[model samples]
Structures are given as C-alpha cells and as structure tokens.
Target: MFKKFSPSTDISGQTPVKSSMQRAIRSSILSSWNIDAETLEAIWPKKESIIHVKCREHISIYTLHNEPLFFQHFDGPVYPTLRLLHKYPFILPHVGIDRGAIRFLLAGANMMCPGLTSKGGRLPPQDAALPAGTPVAIDAEGKEFAVGIGLTTIGTEEMKKINKDVAVESVTYVGDELWAVQKL
Candidate 1:
C-alpha cells in the first residue's frame, strides 16, 4: 500500500545541494525516464534546484527538464521517505511542487487521467507507470510536468474506492496545496 508522509517526517532537513551535483541528478532522472536532454532542460532549468515533499508522502518538484512525457511513467520513488530507490536507481527532484493537493493528484495518476484535482493538461497512452499518488501537469501540446508524487494501495480496486474513475490501482490525494499555480 502507498503510505502517507508529512513535513515533520523530513529526515533530510533543509540541507543545501551543489549545482554540479544537481545537474547530474537531473540528468540521471531524465535518462531513467528516457527523456531527451533538450526537452528536459527546457521544462526544468539548471538554476532551479531543491527537493522536498509537498505532503508527508509525495515528492513535488519542477525539473530542469521539461519532458512532461517522463511523468507518464511516474515510477521514481513511491513515497517521500528518506529512502532512495537505489535498488533501482536514484535521481533527486530539482524543483518541487509547493502544494499538497497537486502532489496527491500527480501521485495518483499520469497527466492522461481525466478530471485532475487541478485543471492541467494530459499525457499520452504510452506505457506509463504510476507509483502511487503522483500528480503531473501537461502543457497545451500534451507534454508532462512532474508536479507531485503519490502513494498507492497495492490493488487497483482499493485505489478506486478512494478515487473512482482513476485508471491506475493507486489512490492519490493532493500532496501540496500550492502546486497548482507553481507547476501548472
């Protein structure tokens, strides 16, 4: 099941990160998601670097890369815990969303889902992978923005109970309240 997170749970505290390292992390995240360098750089910017959870659970951020396409496969880290998915790979978020609600929506499904908690665009039907409650925003042209991350239940039916019509089995609640204006 997708677990929830809160501010008090921030184990990393507000530690500052180096710019070169930030660039590397952004590149890694883009590569893992198979986003091209050009697009990723456009959406996210090199100067914008910071990582934090919107709610206790969701990972919210804007990236140096603008590939909203990457968010369709929202399989980075499931929850906003101190733990990293090194078992698979690790790529820290650069610009995080500021609101919990947007975080919840992104955590729940890709931009493709209808009726997002906030009104943004949608993603394509490519093999998108949802982690849990990850919320994403799409541009008018259908690109994606990794607005916030999500927590999910293991089974699809269970997720539907929390949010009906949501295709993925994971249920998403908004992680950050300010994510709408920031990312979208």
Candidate 2:
C-alpha cells in the first residue's frame, strides 16, 4: 500500500485563523481524541495563536505558536502533527509494528496488515472495537517513540483475520513534508 511521495513547494496563502475557528478545531480534537478540556487548554494555551495554512487544494494545516499541530483534510478528520505525537503519544489510539516496518513507514508507506499482526506487533484490546478511519499512533517494537499517525482501514476483528492488505494508511510520518514544514 506504499506510494512514492514528493514534497510540495507552495506556501502561498497563510493567515491567522480566527478565534471562532480555533474553538471549533479545539472541540474537534477533544471529541475525537477523548481528551478533557483542561488538557486541551494546557496543550494550547490562550497566548498562542492558531494559524490556518493552505498547503494545497485540499490540505490545510493548523499550527500552534508556529509549531504544526494538526493537518485537516477536506474529506477526513484532522490528524495530529508528529510534534504533538512526540510530546503526547498516549493522546491517541496506538498500533504497534515490527522494527522492520519502521523504515518503510518513515518513507511514507501505508502500514501493511502483516506488520501489525506479526510476532513483534501488538494492538491494544481496547482498540479492537474502534471503527475504521480512526486516527492512531504507530509505534515500533522495542522503541519508546511513535513513528507517525495513520487511519485504520479495517476494524480489529477484520484485521485479525487478514494476513495481507493495507491496514493503516499513513497520513503523516517522521520525514514527510508535514514534518519538514515545521522548520520553515
């Protein structure tokens, strides 16, 4: 399920997002991740401004104090940035993968089912009931770091039955443009 990805060069239209819009975004994060309002407040203090960045036709990125926080897709849920993942890995559901699959995922490959069902992989029992398209963090075996965020292609029961197919579609990873965009 991996595809070759080329980075984008356009940064043409960026402006400060409104407070009203920021509130909606905050609400979306709270409800989607099951996080409390206080936690959200702490992560995103009132002093920081949330910027709306249009990277392309359907891709919009939100940044807090100039650090990328989420990428909103026109047709999907907003995905937390890798910076957010590194700071708060437990904030999202997790899917563990074997060490061998780490390189592929970093290269923007969609996570294969076998990687999650293999010997070194483990999926939490609580995540078994989560619906497809739920955002999740990816962790490699024996590593304390989260590699990226992905959308589930199937629920756990179906995932357990399959040996080959795309399990998680990579939205953003360590080396993707979303990650690199942070430095600019």
Candidate 3:
C-alpha cells in the first residue's frame, strides 16, 4: 500500500471555522460515530483553534493545530480523521482484516467478503445488525492499526452468507490522496 501512494499536489486553502459551524461539526460527529458529547468536547476543546479546507469538490477537511482531525462530505455524514483513529482506535464500528489485504486496500481496492471471512479476518459482532452504507473502520488483525475507512455494501448477515463478493467499498485508506494531502 505504501508503494502505491504518491504524494498529492493539489492545494487547498484553509479558513477559520466559525462557532456555529463548530457546533454543527460536533453534533455531526457525535451522531455519525455514536460518540458521547463530553468526549467529543474533550477531543475538540472549544478554546482551541480549528480550520477547514475544501480538499475536494464536496469534501471539507477539518484540522486542529495543523493536524487533520476529520472530514465532512456535503451529501454524507462526517468521517473520522486518521489522526483521530490513532487517538481513539475503537470509536467507530470496524471490520478486521488480515495483513495480506492491507496493500490492496491502500491501493484503493474494495474489500471482498473473503477478507473478512478468512482465518485472520473477522467482523464486529454488531456489524451484522448495521444497515448498508454505515461507515466502518478497517483495522489490521495483529498490528491493530486502522488502515482504511469503508462503507458496508450489505448488512453483516448478508456479508456472512456470501464468500467472494465485495463486502465494503473503500472510501479512503492510509496512503491515499486524503492522507497524502495532509503532508502538503
């Protein structure tokens, strides 16, 4: 995966986030990721300065102290920042994949059912109950690092019934343009 990630050249201008926008961001994060308000407040203190950049046509990336924290898509829910993933590893619903799948994921491939059903891969117990299109963190099995974010294509029960089809569509993963853009 690391081999496939070339640094991005796209430049995005930063703008100070307003108080009303901050409140909306906080609310969206809480509802989308199921995090409590207090924890969200603690992670994003009111006094600290935060800014946002339009990284893509529809996506705006939020940063605090020059570190990317989260991003919001105009038509979708908020997405966890890779930085936040390291700080709060289990905050979002997740699927575990073996090391073999990491490279492909970083290369922008969708996750197949076997990656979640293989000996080294596993799905969260509650994932079977989640609706399609729910955001899910993708973590490596033994390393326990978040490698990607995806949206489930089907409910967990359906995922289990199939063996070779795509289970989750990759939205962003480590080493992709979103991650590389932060380095710019």
Candidate 4:
C-alpha cells in the first residue's frame, strides 16, 4: 500500500482514523449494508475525534484510496456511501416532504413557513446528503429531481442566497463501509 500510494500522518506520527464513534455513523452503515466490524476498521482513518465524524469523513486530513470506485462498487442492496450517513440515523440534516412538497432541508427547518422552492410534503426532515457541487435529490409525487447541493447554511432561505464566496461545508458519508465491502 505504501509503494504506489503514500498514507499521511500528522506531526505526532498517528496513522489515519478508523471512525468508531457515534451510534448513528456505525449503525446506519451496518444495518443498511450488513457491514462487519473488521471491514469498518480497515477504511476509516483510525482516529478518535468526534468532530471528524460529525463533519463527515475528514477528507482534508485523510483521503480515500479511490472515491469513485469506492462508491460505484458499493452501491448495492444498501444505499450508496453518501446516503448511509445522510439519512436513517442522522437527525441534523433531515429529508421529508413537508406539507405535500418534497423538501430536503436540515432537521430544524422552519415548519410554520417552510421556505421551500419546490415540492413540500409529508416527508421527514432529514438533510439531504449531497456531494460537493452536486445536486441534492428530492422525490415528491413519485418524481425525483435534483435540487441544489445541501449548503453550509443552516436554513432553506440562506441556501438560496449563498454566494460564490461563501465557505464550503464538508459533505458527510460512509466511505469506510464501502471500502470494507470493496476489500472483500
């Protein structure tokens, strides 16, 4: 793994993490994909930091071997890597059709007056997990269309007005589960 590739370590000489906190992170991946413990350990960065998992994989700190392959090969019975972390267990970013409109917003979306541009219905309030620069998905009336990417902004209104200069927030996913399955 070191000849053709080089894994990085911080100044303290710690290896990458094996993300093993947060029941949401682990359970979502395992229950959805039937992943095992050994597999989860192999792909994660081997760190024990809460912030890293909360903000998704620490892409800046330790990158995957090949993210595209990681996703493609693993999109099986379970959802792809991104959906595993974005839905099911996570409470912050919720996906639901609020008041008959399919709205994908953060969990604490303004219910009384949902600032939805399109479909808002009876779906859950889970943050749609979007890849950076990719469109998020919203399904209403059996139709699925790509919405704008989930923003770093907190509310639906702020997301509409985000400018090019705004700082990018990290996207979350379960790459470890994919990697583990791929290795098998």
Best by TM-score: 2
TM-scores for every candidate against the unseen true structure: 0.33, 0.89, 0.84, 0.26
Q: Regarding lDDT, does 1 or 4 come out ahead?
A: 1
* Model 2's TM-score against the true structure: 0.89
lDDT by candidate, in order shown: 0.34, 0.78, 0.76, 0.30
Query: How much is the lDDT of residue 121 in candidate 2?
Result: 85
User: Model 3 misses residue 164 by how many Å?
Assistant: 3.4
Clashing pairs in 2: none
lDDT of 2 by residue, 10-89 (tens): 55567998888888887888889857777778888766878887765577777777776777778578787888878877
Q: Mind giving the per-residue lDDT tens digits that candidate 4 earns over 74-154?
A: 222212334333332231233333334323122212222233333543223336332233212232344343221222333
In angstroms, how far off is 77's CA in candidate 1? 3.3
Regions more than 4 Å wrong, model 2: 1-8, 126-128
By lDDT, the best candidate is 2
Q: Give candidate 3 misplaced runs (Cα > 4 Å).
A: 1-9, 126-128, 181-184
Query: Which ten contiguous residues of candidate 2 have the minimum total lDDT?
Result: 1-10
Q: So what's the TM-score on candidate 1?
A: 0.33
RMSD of 2: 2.6
RMSD of each: 11.2, 2.6, 3.0, 12.6
Cα lDDT, model 3, residue 25:
78
